[model samples]
Target: MNNQYILLPASPLFIAFSLIVAFVLNLMPWGQMVGVPDFVALALVFWNIHQPRKVGISVAFMMGLLMDVNEATLLGENALAYTLLSYFAIMIHRRVLWFPLRTQALHVLPLMLLAQAVQLVIQLLVTGKSPDWFYFSESVVSALLWPVVSVLLLAPQRRAVDRDENRPI
Candidate 1:
């Protein structure tokens, strides 16, 4: 064996920390719950775009499951939404990363909409009522927060000049 292995740009520690922070943001006490940012979903999208190999669909689904239980929503609603988000991230990860942050935001907005749409459809099916238009404000806010989240998560990561050494990683 050559004993060579590829290293990721972001450390797993920072990744997990960022995710925790995202979760915290989502849980923050916003007086109006209508437009709160889907911070956890944004974090998942960020990791999926930047670190797809490590944070795959399974991880997103599990996170969604946790969110479902925590929010007392339909059991699999968030799971399905998250899985769809993860799948979209994995599918276009390469393309998304090739652009500037602004452009990437444009690209990611649709995926965020899709995830939220999935939840809306599921809610309609289960509850027999359509969610109000305000529900989608979260997607818009999350999209606008994309650059901030990207910078926050990626700032600590430094690319290696040589793959042979692993210090900051």
Candidate 2:
């Protein structure tokens, strides 16, 4: 059996679970001085990098719309940012996936920054003023969290590897 071709179920349950987790994290009360990290963006980026075919631009856009509604920000601000971010992720998916986790983190940092910049620009356009630079701090925190998020999300696969290694070969 070709491991790469193995068909895993695209569990809607997991998708819903991820989105709910993201929403809950976003809704948590954080100080104005210390912006909350973007959990949805982190999750979306992790899934998109790991399962680009399943979590593509459309999923990102939809997630972004939900985020916009949840955050009560401009209607399309997050949607546009997410769509662009998803596209960028997909474009680099192949190369990014081949790198070490630390290297991948470096690669994704710019994308995270770009996504935040886009969202900030949209908010500025809508409100005629920019948000505090602190809001963009979430991207830095998100990038820092990427390796941890990737490890957590990839735990099942790692366990499967361990199981295979322990099996008769």
What is the C-alpha lDDT profile of model 1 across 36-67, one tens digit per residue? 87888899999999899989999899989988
**After TM-score superposition, what is the CA distance of residue 5 in candidate 2 from its true location, in Å?**
15
> Each prediction's Cα RMSD?
6.1, 4.0
Summing lDDT over every window of 10 consecutive residues in candidate 1, give the lowest-scoring window. 1-10
- Cα error, residue 26 of model 2, in Å, equals 1.3
Local accuracy of candidate 2 as per-residue lDDT tens digits, 8-67: 444666756876798788777765746467788778887787788888999889988988
Model 1 residue pairs with clashes: none
Candidate 1 to truth, TM: 0.85
Q: TM-score of predicted model 2?
A: 0.84
Itemize residue pairs with steric clashes in candidate 2. none
For model 1 the local lDDT of residue 20 reads 82
TM-score per candidate, in order? 0.85, 0.84
